[model samples]
Target: MELQQMRYVVAVAETSNFTRAAEQCQVVQSALSHQIARLERELGAKLFERTSRRVRLTSAGEAFLPAARQALDAAERARAEVAAAAGEIRGRLAIGAIPTVVAVDLPAELKQFHLRHREVRISLRSGGSEELIERVQQGTLDVAFLGLPLGVRPKGVHGRELARGDLVAIVAPGHPLADREHVDLHQLSDEPFVDFPPRTAARAQTDEAFAAAGARREVAFEVTTVDFMARLIRQGLGVGMLPAAFVPDVPDLPVLRLRDAPARMEHLIWSRFPPSPAAAAFLSGLGISAA
Candidate 1:
């Protein structure tokens, strides 16, 4: 009926001696014996037989002992699980990321996180900043790596400033702008451009920064994926403004800083606590440069 009763039954079954089981359980012998007797009485069967020399299980005791052991074991396992879920060392983490981080930082950060907490499972999703912010607000994601300001103030979601840098204009090495130390918004005013969809972080930074400088855009393409955008740029289809951190492994695609453009914003966000131990561990683990 009670976990204590099951525990008493299990102890008696394990030691086969009231005195020994009581000593092991840090309880007095007669008190342990009385509790076990009470348990057997409640069950309508004697669970043990005792003589002057020793104690042993009754036929019912033999049958019930294994069940008692299993019950205690199950109770212990459940307690451990609940405790772990509360603040224990390991569990699953669902994180949302802006598309740029998936290409730039997530891999290394994830590697360090897993190195410290091998038992935790991690899931990552990539999307535009607003979509990721919405997922965090709707409880669909535990955390997000954001590259732009949430277009509007978002509720139920909070962010930590991760890194702040400018958007770099990327072009193939042989392109006319690649050799320039700095590229101005005016240089690309008539040249074709690859852009993030409207209202997205990438779009806002590119549009606002250049427009503020009185530079106009010649829209050549609109695409969301960083890699694909780079591919398009490599082909000279259009040049794109990407997070300053994105450097293509290919030597031919040079990313140039937009000295003439406004700065790009970056952040990491999460649903309000209760944050997982994993989340705290991750945020703490990030470099001071990123934090």
Candidate 2:
């Protein structure tokens, strides 16, 4: 009913605990409970279902959550615009990144952005591209630098391609296949492959690479996390197919070229909303690409 009510709803939804949400709002739990009850009453719908152990959003809550968050975002963006007009930029920003970007390349860029925008506080979250995408859609992130090109969706966000890399075979340095200039998929068809789990966008690309090459890559193991796959590769359990940037040592395992495999493109993505002056200036300095 009120902006304050929506703010409280968002806080509760995020923390999933009345006590924690109250703490975040710096208010008493009783007041939060009372306000939330009032909000539900005004809406004539049950927003959340509470139990002794947990609080979960009802369907109504799920529908209302994004709208509420977007309303808050619009207000905040307006405030930021006003502040920028007065020559100041200050706000909290949540950013998301996938494993490859988080481990291989984003540190330097993030450091540079931070140094240049001392007033813009940034909170970074790391997950698989899928999780990052949902967060971006849910307004939990102001921006995200995530992906493996084909592994994302057309959402209400903007994206800029950062770089493209081949899906390189990752092996241990002493692996026998390291001597070759280009180890094609046929050479390692019998070798166990550590891979992204099936049904993922990256997996689709990886599958296409093997299918088009007519190479039957054996699934020695499948994992959701890049770290797990890397460890398996190091242990010689399997060879992983990963973006070139993710595996710095091609010689470790065999650096195989998947014939006609889709090039993985890492990108810098953000909500479509106008950025704060600090974000805008930093983006200009970084020169994020749309390709």
Candidate 3:
């Protein structure tokens, strides 16, 4: 019934381990467990089935989860609103971004925002475009930086395009195409490629571009991190295509301009609803109205 108890429950549900939840909540495991146990006693329902190996929510816990989240959200919003009325912006801002983000100097912006709003806490997570958008829409992320194929705007969220640029091919120094100033997709069709996993937004851009250009290429290495992809390219395992702006991150790789390449659009997206005061202030600083 208490907000603290609900918070413990929510944390436990999310982490699925009492120890981990306690760590996340910044409390001792015994205290968190005692609080949750007391809350369950008051409700006359067992909230979780705990074993040494795993912990899972019971039916009652599952049913109570949504209302608990709503209550916590409402309480946090009320607190933030009161703080804002007192001429202070105080809240947590969760931001998500793709690894290839280059449209905005994220670290610089975050440092500036922190200096301006010392009372606000900020956290950042990296994810794919779709996952970041979903987190924003779910209110878990206050804002997100997404990279999607050109002409593909984020659905069910408010987004402002920051920049658009074509992808460039990168090859090892000893590769045959490394000396070329520029090449078309068809010209590199024979080269094995290193790219993101299939079905991801990042991979779709390259896949669609190749299909449109009537070029068939093999993706011999599929990796998650850009660093790994860059390493593979450097070893001559496969050719990699990345945004021109991002090429600087993987230095020493020979970059070849692609005459026919997929264009990526970088965007800042947020929930459609009115943003928290902290988020609004941050957006306003960037000249974006988070209305």
* Model 2 lDDT per residue over 1-291, tens place: 777788899999999999999999999999988998999998999889999999989999999998998788778778777877888776666878776673335577768877866777778887767677777666677677766655544477787767777777777667787566677777878888888777666677777777878878778687877778877888878877787666563334556665564567777777676665655765666665322
Cα shift from native, residue 48, model 3 (Å) = 1.2
| Residue runs of model 1 more than 4 Å from their true location after superposition | 1-81, 85-87, 102-104, 149-155, 248-250, 287-291
Better of 1 and 3 by TM-score: 3
- Angstrom error at residue 10, model 3: 2.2
Against the unseen true structure, what C-alpha lDDT does each candidate score?
Answer: 0.73, 0.74, 0.92
Q: After TM-score superposition, what is the CA distance of residue 151 in candidate 2 from its true location, in Å?
A: 13
Per-candidate RMSD, Å = 16.6, 3.6, 1.6
| Per-residue accuracy of model 3 over 1-291 as CA lDDT, tens digit each | 799999999999999999999999999999999999999999999999988899999999999998998799879878988999999998788899999999999999999999999999899999888889889988889999988987898888998999999999999988987889989999999999999998788999999999999889999999988999988988889999899999999889999998887998999998999999989998998999876
The lDDT leader among the candidates is 3
Rate residue 213 of model 2 by lDDT: 84
**Predicted model with the maximum TM-score:** 3
Candidates in order, TM-scores: namely: 0.64, 0.81, 0.94
Clashes of each: 0, 5, 0
**Which pairs of residues clash in candidate 1, taking residues 3 or more apart in a chain or in different chains?**
none
Better TM-score candidate (2, 3): 3
Candidate 2: lDDT of 70?
Answer: 79
Error of 3 at 148 (Å): 1.3
lDDT of 1 by residue, 1-291 (tens): 677777777777778778788888899988887887788878999888889977888999889876776676456545546756776656556788877763236788788888878877888998888898888776557688877643434456767666676677778768877888787788878888988888887688778877888988877788878778878888989888766665554446887777675565567787774555555566667632112
lDDT head-to-head 1 vs 2, winner: 2
